[model samples]
Target: MHLNYTVGYIIPIVLDALKDTELSGDWWDIQPGVVRLCGDTVEERTKNMDKTTRRWREAQRFEILSGWRDEIYTVYAPKGSPFFYMERSAHPLFGVLAYGSHMTVYVPATPTTPLRIWVPRRAAGKATYPGMLDNTVAGGMGNGAGPWECIIKEAGEEASLEESLVRAKAKPVGFVSYFYVRHKEAGGEAGLLQPEIEYCYDMAVEAPDSGGPTLKPCDGEVAVHILMDIDEVVANLKNGKFKPNCSAVLLDFFIRHGIITAENEPDYLEIYTRLHRRLEFPTR
Candidate 1:
């Protein structure tokens, strides 16, 4: 659908299903290569869309919207433009761009130890990517929260990190952008496109004896937090143990830290380009 620009694409399955349903309201217009919402203002469009999506969620007809997270994500038209808000679960159905923040918390190498990162395993019963290894702190930017705000909230909730420590130590790095096609492994209808951007951060903590913050699972969303050596993290990434985007974030961290350099990695340039991929769609 073209808002200010092409905000999202209604895939074939979703399009056919939508066509079968009664599009009674003046909510949307579907054309050959364009789908437009009738509402002129952002508030108007959001209201109309939210009402429609609520109906879809309640009806339980659309498989993509079946497991409603109840979290609302702000959609951007091209980039830095607020378009409207949608339920997080329905984002893939429309091929919308998703944004989140991931923070890597690590202890620097000392004379007795190598640099190590705190990695969390997702709770097995979670709706998506359960039991997968993830960045130390990660959460979607929902309800209009910015990256730093999101990280601070997530750091405490997911990793049991102190807000004061996070606020004082978290360093905003760059981001990792990618175009991903969801597979069955992602626990939903396969082949849905997700052009995503992850705002990355790094937090370097002192060893436990030095009075640094320790990480533990505060919420049930994370099964456990494990501090692992850098080499172990590399091995896990090689084996696809981390969630796809989490792996990407860790790789971005490696590149930023000069651990994966042109001299050591053959695809250095390609990796750099892929990590900072320019999205065709608008972003916030």
Candidate 2:
């Protein structure tokens, strides 16, 4: 029930719910319905944790556990308890967590700097997700690991990012919980979305080195990534435009880290009051 746990098929919305709530634990989003997939096979899915996970069900879990992507309710469990355990999703040996994290990445530097950030495009033949871009790094948290550990692991898997570098730049931002229910678009209340809660994190990296490992395409559902304005890009989302899900998470991260001001209203150049503002970029 920690206010950070999220319950939703969509990770960002879950985070938003957590940010919006005043309560702190085992809570869920008040969604109208669950997400549904096309055809059979992947349809009619349910949340069934393993024996180890089932054992933890009685623990005073503060977050969601074991579920699918289009699910509604997140069977929440707390940390240091057994109500949850890790298992496979999409693949048997893939070892995705019953609980996990979703995080955001920012531009290399201030808006005035000639730096940039990238977002992934949804691929051509996606199965469930058609053309919706998502976070810079996201992954299922496994059993026995901490939320920070889950985020660090996800960064490596989703973006091929370096571990220590991610750790150095990232820190906890918030949590979200996805509740279960059914809707016309989601098929039915029985067809809730997956991953009820997403532990969120935020960071500012030192613009990645080109020679470093790049973000590998996941299952052809994602297309080539892109670079654009944080504000301009996200605004496109309202018009059905495609932007990475984690972009706003990045904005949130900046806010939590005191990087983004409450007023992006004026613009990054308004800092001229002190020609000697402590704006310095380390030369690596």
TM-scores for all predictions = 0.93, 0.49
TM-score of 2: 0.49
lDDT of 2 by residue, 63-107 (tens): 233223322212232343232223333211111123457776656
Error of 1 at 32 (Å): 1.1
For all candidates in order, the CA lDDT equals 0.85, 0.44
- Maximum-lDDT candidate: 1
Per residue, candidate 1 scores C-alpha lDDT tens digits across 213-276 of 7688988999998889999999999988899989889999999988899999999999989989
lDDT of 1: 0.85
Task: Determine the C-alpha RMSD for candidate 1 after optimal superposition of all C-alphas.
Answer: 2.0
Top candidate on TM-score is 1
Kindly report which residue stretches of model 1 are placed more than 4 angstroms away from their true locations once superposed. 1-4, 23-26
By how many angstroms RMSD does model 2 differ from the true structure?
Answer: 14.0
Error of 2 at 255 (Å): 4.7
